[model samples]
Target: MRKGILIFTLISFLLLNTPVLAQEPLNNIDLQPFLKLTMNVTLVNTGEYPKFIAVNPTYDFKTFREGDEYLLHNTTDLIQLSKANLILNKRVGFWIYPHEVLKVEFSINIPMDLGELYLQDYADLCYPDYTITWSTKRITYPPSLGVGPLCEVVYPHLINYPILVDLTSFIQVRDPEIVIYSYSGEVEFTITNRGPKTMFAVALPLIPVDAKIYSITPNPDMNYTEYMGKFLPTYLKSQVQNAKFNLTQESVLFEYTDTLLSTMSSQQNLIQNSITTNEDIVDYPIWIVVLGENSSFDIKYKFQWEFTR
Candidate 1:
C-alpha cells in the first residue's frame, strides 16, 4: 500500500510540473490608413500555460532605384517613418494567460515623403512602397519566474511567428509640379500640388553666376538651415572674393655743397604711392526648399553683385 501511494504521488507531481505541448499563440494585427496611422494588435493564447510574448514592429521599403548608381533616389531619402505621439504606451510586451485574449494598441507617425528635386517622367516610377511587420517571440521561461531557458532554442519554432502587413495602399504618393527660375540677382522656386493627396517636394535652387546672396525671403525648412550651418560655411566663404587695398610711401633727399662761397644747400623730396585691387565677387547660397502638398510656396532669394576693378 505504501509503495503504491508513493508511486501515485510522484506521477501527480510530474504531470503537474511538466509543460504541455501546445501551439504557439495567434497574432492578429490591424493597421489604420496613412492619414491616421495606428495599429490594433490582438494576441490569443490557446495553450494550457501562460505565455510571455514580446511583439516587435519594424518596417521596410521597396523602391525602383537601388544601389550607389541611384543613391539620390534611395528609399530613405524619399520617405521617413517615426512613432506618433499618443497617450497609449508604445511598448508592446505583456503576459497572456491560457485561453485569454490580449489587445495591444499603438500609433505611428504618418509616412512623410521628403519630396523630390524634379518630377519623375512616370507617376509610378521613383516612388517607394513600405511594409510593416511584427515579430512575435514566446519566451519559454517567463522572466518573472526568475528562471532562464534550459537550452537555446532557435527562432521560428513552434513558439515564434512573424506577421507581415502590407502598407502600400497608404503610401501611394503622387508627384507634384515644380518650377524654378534663375534671375540676374535672384532665384525663384515654385511648387504646385495638383493631386488629391498632399505632396512634399524638395527644390534645389539654381544660383546665377557672380551673384552675392543677401537674404532668403520666407525662410526655408530647418534641414536647409542645419545643412548650411554645419557643412557649407567654409565652402561658401571660398567662393567670395574679399576686397583688398594696399598703400606705400617713399621719400628721397639730395644735398649739394658749393665750395666757392662755402655755402651748403639741402633739398628734400617726398613721394607717395597707392595701389588698389579688385576681382569678381561671386557667392552661391545652396538652398533645399521644401514645398507642402496641395499648396503653393514661393522661395525667393535676394542678392546683389559686389564688383571692383
Candidate 2:
C-alpha cells in the first residue's frame, strides 16, 4: 500500500512539474498621433511560466532616406520590468512573469541637416511613409523535460508600425535666382531659405560638365563632384587590339592588318551610334551645393560647349 502511495505521489509530482507548450506572446505597437516621433510598445506574456523576452527594433525607410542610424533614438524605457538589458543591434531584453504586461517607450530625434528634398517630397503628396519593425522572441523557462532539445524553446513574432511625419511647421526653401553670362559661359545661382526652423547642409543639384566651381556668399562646408561614363565592350576590345599590335607589319600580315583596321573602324562607328541613340549612356557630372537655413548664398561656375558646322 505504501509503495502504491509513493508511486502515485511521484506521478503527481512529475505531471505538475512538466513544462507545457504555449503560443507566442501578444505584442502591440502604438505611435502617438500628436507627437512628432514618439512610439509605445506593449508586450504581454500569456503563458503560465516565466518568460525571457527580447525585442529588436528596426526602421524601414520606404520613401524617406535609408541608412540614417542617427535618426533613431537608442534609449528605451521598459516600464514593468525593473531591469532592462541593452543587447546587440539596438535590442532590449528583460524577464517577465506570467500574465505580466511590459510597456516600452521610444523617442526619435530629427536632425537639422535633414535636407529639403525630404520635406518637398512630403509636400508634393508623395508621402514619405516609414515603418518600424519589432522582432520579438519569448523563451519559456522552468526548463523543458529531461533529455529534451538543448536549445531554449522560443516563440517568435513580428510587429510592424507605420511612422507619421508632419512637415507643415518645417523649414521652407524659396525658389533660387540664376544668372547666365553668354560670353564667358559663367553662371551664378542664388538660393534663399525662409524658415521658422534652422536648416543645415542642404544639397542642390547642378547640371553642368567640366565646371570651375566656387561658393560666393556663405562659404560651404565641402564641394563634391563625380563623373560617370559608359564604355562599350567593342570599344574596349578595339583598344586592346590596338595596344597589342605593332606598327611594322610584314607583307604576309598586310591583308590581315587591313581587315583588322576595317573591323576597328566599324566597331568605332557602332560605339558612336550606340552612344548617340541611348540618352542614358551619355556621361553625366554631379555637383552638390550645401546651404544653411534662413540664409542666402551664391554659387558661381563656368562651363562651355562647342559646336561644329
Best by TM-score: 1
What's the C-alpha lDDT at position 287 in model 2?
27
Question: Could you tell me the TM-score of candidate 2?
Answer: 0.20
Tens digits of per-residue lDDT, candidate 1, 254-293, equal 1111201011123332211111111111111233423233
Best by lDDT: 1
Model 2 residue 260 lDDT score: 17
Model 2 Cα RMSD, 1 decimal: 31.5
Q: Can you list the residue pairs that collide in candidate 1?
A: 115-200, 199-293
In candidate 2, what are the lDDT values of residues 43-118, reduced to their tens digit? 4455677654443232111111122221232233222222223333444444445765544343322221112112
Residue ranges of candidate 1 with Cα displaced over 4 Å = 1-184, 199-201, 223-294
lDDT of 1: 0.28
Clashing pairs in 2: none
